[model samples]
Target chain A: MHTDVVHNEQSMTPHPAGSARHPQAGGRSPRRMTPARRREHLINTALRLYSQQSLEDVSIDDIVTTADVSRALFYRYFTNIRDVHVAALSTVVDELIGRLTLPPDGDFRQQLHHTLAEFVTFVETYATSYTALLRSGSTIATSTTDTLVDRVRDHVVDLFRERLGHSSSSPMLERTLRGWIAVVETTLLSWLQHTDLPREQLETWLTDQLLAMITTTAQHDPTAAEQIRHLLAESGDEP
Target chain B: MHTDVVHNEQSMTPHPAGSARHPQAGGRSPRRMTPARRREHLINTALRLYSQQSLEDVSIDDIVTTADVSRALFYRYFTNIRDVHVAALSTVVDELIGRLTLPPDGDFRQQLHHTLAEFVTFVETYATSYTALLRSGSTIATSTTDTLVDRVRDHVVDLFRERLGHSSSSPMLERTLRGWIAVVETTLLSWLQHTDLPREQLETWLTDQLLAMITTTAQHDPTAAEQIRHLLAESGDEP
Candidate 1:
């Protein structure tokens, strides 16, 4: 039992999934699971693998082997590796979108900070996968994967519009929001790579960047200026 | 010759490379030049083809046909289509980097506006190729292509540092500048796709976005604050 504990120490550690020596070894009972459960298990395994390594390096064989299942069982659920990848990525996207919420009770800046912190958390949880998905020119990137990423951006745009009590977005508002989203992404990507700045500072800096962008846009675009005025009034803050 | 004029009318248009029905026909003579000139002619043809269409669609046959050269001659210079693509992209990068000059005579804002306008012009000139190279998941994207893009970014960072009178960059300044560079890329890619905003507005907006970013960073980073203070003082502008 002591030897088993020593052997499993790597897996027992809560962080640094990359440090696991046998990430795909002996985690599940293959025959006990229903088909749906098995499929979920496979996807979870794939996502776990992706979070620890490059998405291009995670193969069907690795997924099955890690799940302690036969290759036949793996194909029974997903047609191919890319299918599994797409499915796993969709799961991640859904989780990210679902978890992002700007609480109603807080001031706008506080809400924005909390929402961005949530985003940073999600990014941290799936650092490798998020990087692989967003980094251009990855060999494994497909249209399906690209669409999943777009879905997140589109959802965030909608969320912001709804929060601001706007029925629809003007071109200036839309472009400014989308541009800020890109800034968030690029900043997070760089942050993930180097981790030079503290997370709290990065989060606050990102929040401030959006405010700055909106303030800048307001100077040129009357619609943006009016919307920002209303937004600031609602938050009881000065623009 | 008059009939030929009608046939060549598509190519004669001042803009819209995409409108040319035959982008790769009768542009150059085969076997008439020295080997060095012939190789350059082929690369130029490949770039022209890329400018007009998706890089993935431009093939070895297309290059040879456009240059009016034989397959044998094409093989002498390039091992494959991708080789020519890398070469063509390098030329574009070199031209863009070379042409980007922050002239010494203007206020900082004016100089920045002019430099950005030049960049936008380069983007317009190689719109298709630039999109193809930077768009994340083109099947034709290779490590060489990705590296070429990075070279442009790195050069821009160095350019900014030199302009700021900093021999080296602090972490805050580096990240802010790099983040702003990303905003430019993402904004340009979106603009290229939708083109709703006018070129003048886009240029001014991008220039302002960097200013806003620097101001925001100054609040959190002493190094950035000091640098921006110095920068603004030099330009007789407020931060």
Candidate 2:
């Protein structure tokens, strides 16, 4: 389950040349290109170029030419083309993560399903760029992935911690959250690699796995059984 | 958890060129370097150089100078420096996988702990090289990671399938294996990154997580429960 690959895809496209071309050359009454607008233009152009070819196949020259920006301006805004790609990816990830709503009051299974479904849809919709980003594996790309994983880990850990209350620090709860995140990342990556699996089927499969990790007593203390039950119920699970 | 990082460290180091370098610059009777020996030389030199500097910081000239190999020979052996690094990585991963011994008759908990400990130790030993290997998100690096992952996944899945006596096509069992692998990989990676935790402590934590995932019934059907029980029993756990 290599979610790293999914994150990787978003980080690797759009060679830095596009961003480098942003600043007006030989500034004679230079038209001011706002940073935000320049970024958008670069990303949109890069996406279009990335969709048509491999990341390695695309050069910085190609992106600058496509985006109609000066090399100096591009550098002014981005450290490199990879940075631009990562910035684009960060936007997508932020959007995707935002969409993953953990209802303050839904069954853990349902919540897991919703989250997985949303993630799968995002990856599928952006498959080409995603794959390109993953294949690139630049420092910026990896850092973006690390950021995503860290954010997701913190989110899931918080959810479990909230449910577990004071017992949140318990090793068992920590293990459970970590295990679920691991499975989720892996399942997402596998699905991305092999998109033949129906979204619902993948979601259902992941939901069951996550629910089992949360509810089972393999590593949980015997005393926490009731607590687990109460937490599950609060999350809308009957059992 | 980024066990990928650990694996990356073990394989990316290039051999020391000082020992391998030929004294004379002029081609005085070129020593016939076997493909295997040449690969070893390249890996060792690359790892050594990469350790001192970033991947981008290191050049092909640096590697060739250190390896005492002709540029043409280097090309013959690898598409680029990254290719050499990946090959080095694959070798280390294959070795680690080979060393993993799953006791046929230990308790489920014990077997898991034993395997997890072995894996952690392998990663810790090669931590530096793995860091170098995975630092960049190049296509070659990602592909190398995929190959390493596929190898580990195949080995673990086969081990579990044999224990469960499940057909290769069993969806439930397959998912179970994949989930377990995901959890393990994630935990290991986390452990690698978080130096605050002791290796033994981290391994124990990971073992507990893996046991919870395997012993739980999230992905398996009731019919498969018996097989799970058998697995536990074979591992010396009373089901």
Candidate 3:
């Protein structure tokens, strides 16, 4: 008995669910359920419950009851509560990623502002789930979430690459892209951790701050500076 | 027994020490361990044990035998095994924090590079334990970890204010500092997750990337731009 308790405590950390469980028998007539439907049901139910309590406070029983499913059914959909939470949160992250594409014609500043606003809007719309996932670090494993972030990083790098044009080689492009991604991720996470400041204010502030960093760095790197100016000219920005 | 098993599994997710049996008076002589010493012992033992297995795999029997302490003694020090893990992990985080002070007298790029290098060094030194803490979100309380992260953010903010000579009331200072910290944390977490890369290469890449971000961001804002220019001038860089 004692050993069981110890084992349970050790396994409790929320992890990304790698596999979807299939509905099982012995719960309310054993209606057949597909893995996709079961996963969706569990995630929606868990998201609703998590909004009301600490993610840690919600139990398997609460989730099963809320989903109107048996314990076996719950297990069929997710390995644990955290798995459901990740699935629910990934939906919102996916939406944000969809909205953050690079504008075909905008200058770097405009594109950056658009991306920043999209991110803030997503965070605002799903504040509770976003907060829960960020706080728990459970969102780290969701491939969709990672893909969204990576895509944004790639877009930013591409913008810098286009700006650089004929001024740099493969190495410079890699370095610039990597640096931009690191800065953007660090800044976003810090803001998420700190103030619950309203979305518009945060977005504006971040947009301006990011632009400032990009400009200053470019000025110091002669090659990067030439690229920025060329891109600015191409985009018809006032010198 | 069933109820015990449920309770054991639920609690075990956080506390492995719960599995230890309170020794009968004649079963084993209880060691006269101080509270602080016992906690240290438990944390050290758990770290060693946890590193060897998934956080879920280490049992109370594993901890008790390793620590040579009774179950009752373990409970006295921690509410559960998760508490012990958090306490242990907190020590490591605190050590990292202690080493994160910003250096005096350098250009914005140089200062930013130094601070980032410090972070990389800390992460490299505690890579295994750090990765474990990040992976096992189950054992650590979200609120507690957020509070710790907030402290680190404030420290970074203060450094920005001091170095940039910007008042706390300045919105640009707040935005720039907050954004930089966010980028740093996100980059570090991502790097931590990708363990295949060499630490030295990763650190160098991170440092160069962060400096670029800071430099770029500095140029967009008049006040920040001025600060960067002054910093560069002080460092004998020709405008």
Candidate 4:
């Protein structure tokens, strides 16, 4: 998730003559964007459109027109529409990682409650883009470094590690986290389509789901499960 | 896994024209197909192309050309290319359900080992089509009755219910099965892309993972878990 497709697009942007930022030209009615800024502009433009529409339904022309940039300018930064989506998707992944981190406050369940709510909000905000990413067989290419999904998996793992006061996690633990996160992702996607369920109930449902999986994973991998069981026991000790 | 979409497609075939049992036409060269057989022919044609290429890469022109049908005739059944893909996808789902039925075996673990091996074979046979369906937000439309994914979920849930000697399972049991199945589905999709792992090892890994999830879910919902625990104890008694 913390990777380079976006940077690649930035590198690809043609350094057009007038697009360079100039202090002297800044006083003009319309300011020229620096090449880097133009690339960011295009990514943001693409992301905004993607947040509301399906990838199949979205057009390159729709993106460029909304950005008020010519096709030539759009082509300078992205060779294909998928490039723009890839860039936007990486950005969403970054935002997701940031929001998912939890405070060392409440008990394990409390922390989960807090984190799941934030997770749900992020999905709601980027439902369109998130849907688009999930629709791709590889949200971010598997060949590409660790996946954006892996990034989310890491966030959940870090919380478990932190809660358990463990320096490292087992492969079984990692697989459990990966599987649990996939469930959360799939369930959230299903929930997005069916919003009839109230928000609190949905949050409770997600929290229960995560807790249930952790409780289950523990039975198979007792060492890791023991750590979590101890953590829950200790969380009760805190207050 | 016991479901209706595939059966529904089979039933929808019109018993029209000479396509109906043409015992006499059997000797005729290039004999006319009944409406049901013609639909089946087109679906088979589409499935063949889908097996080799991504859905977007396959064209309506490609389907008709492969089937040797004109554009007008193609419209006689399918509304568009997606329609053909959906029909073909349902057929694949039926094949999957048929292959996944469990046999009375050594133990629960032994039965799962047998089922997982068959499941992997089905995916290996239909890798391209499976990939295409997973790329869709829902493998089968969530709105359109029970999905192919849901069908798999039912298979797991039914096994659990039967093994436990329960007439019905809890809500949590159902959710756990749904989530575990999603994990299995996600893992299989990933495993398909990275085939370095040996098939037997992959099957063992998947079986273990499913067992782990069930164990964990049981810990949380002890009513269902107790039933499984007792079943395992009795399986020991059997031998």
Please rank every candidate by TM-score, starting with the best: 1, 2, 3, 4
Chain B TM-score, model 3, reads 0.67
Give the clashing pairs for model 1: none
Candidate 1 lDDT by residue in tens digits, A1-239: 11122112222112325545443355444455556666777777787787778878898888777777789888799898889888888887887888887787877778888989999988898888888888877766777788888898898888888877887866777788788888889888989989988999998888888888877788778887887787666555455
lDDT of 1 at B134: 81
Please write out the lDDT profile of model 3 over residues B1-239, one tens digit for every residue: 11211111111121222234323112432354445555665775675565556555566777787766678877887887667666766765666667677776666556766777887766555555555444324444345655555666677777766775665524444655565555555556666666545665555544544444444445545665566566556544423
Among all candidates shown, the one with the greatest TM-score: 1
lDDT of 2: 0.59
Tens-digit lDDT string for candidate 4 (A1-239): 22222222333321222335322222321125667777776766566666556644667898777766589878988998767766766766777787787766877778878988998878887776566556434333322323665667777888767766887775555565677788778777767776756777767666655555555555556675666776546434211
Best-fitting candidate, scored by lDDT: 1
Compare candidates 3 and 4 on lDDT and give the better one: 4
lDDT of 3 by residue, A28-137 (tens): 32244456645655665565565565555678898787655679877766787666656665654555556766677677667766766776655544445555444444
Q: Which residue runs does candidate 1 get wrong by more than 4 Å?
A: A1-28, A234-239, B1-30, B234-237
Candidate with more favorable, higher lDDT: 2 or 3 = 2
Q: Cα lDDT of model 1 overall? A: 0.77
Note the clash tally of each candidate: 0, 45, 33, 4
For model 4, the superposed segments whose C-alpha errors exceed 4 Å read A1-31, A136-146, A234-239, B1-95, B102-176, B187-239
| Interface RMSD of the candidates, in order | 1.3, 4.0, 5.6, 7.3
lDDT comparing candidate 3 with the true structure: 0.54
TM-score of chain B of each: 0.86, 0.70, 0.67, 0.77
